[model samples]
Target chain A: MVDVVKFSGEKEKFNPNKILKTLKRAGASREQSRRILKDVESSLKDGITTKEILDRVFSGLRETPGIAAKYDLKRALMALGPGGYTFEKYFAEVLKHYGYEVKINQLIKGKRIMQEVDVVAKKDSTYMVECKYYNYPGNYASTKEAMYTYARFLDTNSRMHNFDFPWLATNTKCSWSAIEYSKGVGLKITSWKYPAKESLQRLVEAKKLYPVTVLKTASKFVKQRLLDSGIIMINTLMEMDISELRRKANLSESELKKAILEARQISV
Target chain B: MVDVVKFSGEKEKFNPNKILKTLKRAGASREQSRRILKDVESSLKDGITTKEILDRVFSGLRETPGIAAKYDLKRALMALGPGGYTFEKYFAEVLKHYGYEVKINQLIKGKRIMQEVDVVAKKDSTYMVECKYYNYPGNYASTKEAMYTYARFLDTNSRMHNFDFPWLATNTKCSWSAIEYSKGVGLKITSWKYPAKESLQRLVEAKKLYPVTVLKTASKFVKQRLLDSGIIMINTLMEMDISELRRKANLSESELKKAILEARQISV
Candidate 1:
């Protein structure tokens, strides 16, 4: 047993089970999860911050090719932020893969107000979604955001002849008040791991809509350039020829081939 | 101008114009409003509490038959609580007057949860309402209540094939966060003098569904008995024959007659 210090300055006995479980949730096999936990446990010392342990695990996973793809996913998702627009586009692609016709940044006129809907999806029913992207992991979508989205729905729905479903989708978990408010207003919500069966992770895994930020071989500058040119999804890059990718992403031939190979290898 | 102390213990110069505006909003004529203000101004003393001013206004209005009906309205609405169930029934009656088919204390099953709705009204559209009744005038319906109500709406609507409007109607004002949150969730809200044209006072005055507690002639005990018997609205009481009113409300013959006559006079 090792004493670990949390971000809040509290000390508690560290449990290796927590790390093992997290590794498994990220798609590691049982053997790989146990191996990762053993490595983390061997490096643990008294007063080590939880952040340091996570950094160690992340760096250690890079040496293991088989499990690195799964482990890099959470880190890649976190890196997509501080800029919410990229996440929204990425989210739109995920929804599109689920068979919904999606339009981003749409303006609709409601009875009493004009609303800017982040994404409008249509299948049998029209859905107006407010995409909340947080730069940091711990930040939550608040009740205030949920309330405002609902009001916009009311305004827009009053003017429409057809019924519209209001949804609040965030990159991170919503606050307790936000979740409660969303449920009360008939607003569907999808957060990172909330709603269990239909969370962002579930959708990502089901649709295989992995973002380019997850490719460990790509440099931050190359990733940013590709993201800027709207090449967000790994599938999108994989579909493109290496020459086209080099031209669009402003990458060297060698870097482009490596990125494309990494995207192809991990996505499968 | 007289200086008055607020409930929060802040002293400010009292303006008679503020009183006049409040009277007018409650449906008092200009002449009657000015007369009431003059009486309040003359009686005012330095460092008087805001509650004391309201008390003086209420007492002074009781003497004037022409203006009393309008001024007692705010007070009567405030008296509806300590018991929220009674208020829900009273609110149902008000909805009924607006041509809605109303049900009180209904159980509805949502996709994820079952909800006990305070009142449900159906007309062209269905409305699920949560009634918040506060016993005292100074108390406000809070953000926590709004959040919970929204969650219930979400759960219930998930199972429903038809569209339903979720509304929160309170006899008192809602807190700032509550109001903000209600808007976000698309939850319709009706509170005392809130949202200007769609407030509870506006709805009551439009339909003339004044509750029995609004009658200055009825004592607290008698009012409670009438409410307990489900004789909530003035219109409902006015429709009842004197003998039935006495039997159902357990009021003395004279008290019944006086109450019935007051209901009849004020309703017109």
Candidate 2:
């Protein structure tokens, strides 16, 4: 057994089962998951840092053709970042692909005051989505965010013609109390791996609308450029030819080809 | 001479001097301003509502060829409404016209947390301008606003590279204490006719960047449409051809002509 240096600098016995579980959760095949776990175990030294272990696992997964494309989806989502605006934009694009007419950063006129809505989506009825992006995965959308969304909904309900649905979308999960309060107020919630069917993961998988940040092959600069151009979803890049994509995104030949391949494989 | 009802419902003596003062402030020639005031005095009736008096004056100003287009610059500015966002946008445009690169609703990362700056402007140095737009001209920006702006400045100064100037820009006057506190903290302030030379009115007149809402002839819908399309300044409307303005704003022929005439007059 190898000793793993935790983020806090504390050493702990490395658990191969944890890597296997993470690989399985990422939709890796049973055989491939076990093989990657073996690779990670072999690479781990007596006092390997947790980050090094993760790097080894990511590299080992990339070597596998079937699950390599989806290896960083969870990490990439986390990378969408310290600011909530980008997450809101990416989620708006996802909802748009799911057939909702979405407007992001909308200044909605409430009865008493003005509200800046993250994303106002319209289909059968209007849905106001509040996106909460957390840089750290451990952080959860709390009751404060839910309560604020509820207050905004109450203020804007009269202005909306159709039935107003207040929804909270977050890259991370919500606190138990937040979920309870949201349910009490009839506020819909979509967080990572929550709500089973309507979670963010499920929604993205159902529509194959992955954010550009989720591309493992793309660098931070490339992701930012794509986001700035309103190309948040991987499917948007897939719709364009390789030459056009390269030219528009200012990507090198190798970067473009790798991005397209990863996007196509993961989306499929 | 006729009687005019005040906002408090008191029957007040009709004063043509008041009208003359307003016209002169709006940059009307002395002779034309007196004539317009005389016309307003003739139109005033016994126990006339303040609204009726304003309507008559606006109508009378519209008849003048030279300054008719610039009539109601002050009133229209006040009409930018019950909300502060429009005022912020208008002031930002005014600053932009003054050669300052302006950004509205910018999230500035502070030392402790994030601060939402109403207007971040840069020329020789960075100026963070907090706009306090009160619908009722009587409502002055109080000490609370000044203190909050000063607090934000302290938090943002270390983050800015250049000399940071904290400014408070309001559509109305600041309270006495607010002025005193601002002076103590070296915070620059611009209010309606307060600073005399550097006031909001002065800035608007210097650049001739009046907001579209100042047009007494334009309907609420037309003004809102113009605002939504990022056409805040009166000069922006003047730059467009009448045909394009009518098509884009979806204005009636009369409304289009009146708006264009007023925009062209005021900008010149």
Candidate 3:
């Protein structure tokens, strides 16, 4: 076991199973994963940061093209915006994919006022999820934001928007205080890395619902332009032929060829 | 009587007594108020805006030197500060003068988080006021703001901050929707002209607690500078000798003399 420093400053002996599990989740073959793990372990220095180790593993996944994209889901989710339906629409699609009837940016009329709810979904129970998307790296959602969002839900939840549950969905982690208060008040939250097996990251990975921005074949600038034009999901981009994709999104022939190749790989 | 259009676009026969009453309230003697009202009415045309009448009346008060300053109280309160104590300090002093022990910018700890309450006051009951000061003309507080404030109060009011009453104090009006929701949620509000008898303007005038910026004698630039330096109260400036006043505020000899003379006029 190699001694490693985690992101939170915890010193731990690195477990091969952890990286191996992630590699398997990213759809890399068992032999390919073991070989990459061996190469990483060979180069690892004791007390090296988890960040460094993850970066190495991330670059190592490029050997398999689309597999690396699946592991880069967190960045892709955060990259889901500044466009009209990239974040909220993406979340709504994810909800719909899970068999929940969904509404995006619905204007809700309460007893006294009209407020817009980001994503309202219902399955066994109705839930209104307020999406807080921030692009700043490592910026945790503040306690005030969680409280404010919950307060709006509470203020109007009395007679309108009759959501059985109030949930805050964010692309970033929430502050510890926000988490504690949210739990105390019964306001459920889903963030990039929170709530364990049901975190935003976990949910996306479990479902294999990768955003088009995740594809390594697409340049960041081209991906952003495509995202701007509202072609966010890899499934949507994969379904479009090269001519249709060119008509919808400004992509060069070579870029289109590579993107389609990776999209196909990811689809498999 | 003149047919005048008010700000709200209502056409009504203007009541001279209304202007007379405001003049009297501004500390003008009945005889002076009657003469000024006569001048204002003579100049008013049919379908004239209430704003035109108010402006003429405002300029009319300049002849009385300090009397116009009292009438300019609403603008003065709104003009309170871009400085440290200009708005919050002025409000705290106004509350303190009215027998509420006040704290400005208190870092209040809620059950799970520490939040800043703008002004916390204790009178017959403990109250926390969130002051929404907007310098823009006619910008009303929104329902979202009111709900967010009350939500924070509710979130932490169970154990800490101990505020028995919650208030959203603003320099501008609260939108009708905001007002209704705030009332529905039991969140009190005070704006420039609200609650009829005890609005911010009424409270300031009832105690003759005029800010330094209310002085028409001082140039707007000079008054803003003085407000920036925290010499906001005219009474404080009035009590100081001209040299001391000059030392404390960046007032020239001429400005100091005029400000003191007007301050004395209002003082009486």
TM-scores of the models, in the given order?
Answer: 0.50, 0.47, 0.68
DockQ of 2: 0.01
DockQ of 1: 0.03
List of clashing residue pairs for candidate 3: none
lDDT of 3 by residue, A36-66 (tens): 8987898788898877877888777877777
Per-residue C-alpha lDDT of model 2 across residues B99-144, encoded as one tens digit per residue = 9999899887654445578998899988888888887634678765
Candidate 3 docking class: acceptable
- lDDT of all predictions: 0.76, 0.74, 0.79
For model 1, fnat equals 0.00
TM-score: model 2 vs. ground truth: 0.47
True contacts kept of each: 0.00, 0.00, 0.68
Off by over 4 Å in 1: A1-13, A25-29, A161-163, B1-268
Candidate 3 residue-wise lDDT, B13-108, digit = tens: 989888887788778988788778888878988889878888888777767877888876766776775543458778888888889999888887
- Higher-DockQ candidate of 2 and 3: 3
How many steric clashes between backbone atoms does each model show? 12, 1, 0
| Candidate 1 per-residue lDDT over residues A1-268, each given as its tens digit | 6799875477889988778877776667788777777888878898888888888787767755435655556567767866678887888899999998999988776553355678888888888888888765456787656765675566567646244788888877787766766676688889887778999888986766788888777789888888988899888988988778877877798887887887766666
Candidate 2, superposed: residue stretches over 4 Å from native? A1-18, A25-27, A41-52, A160-163, B1-268
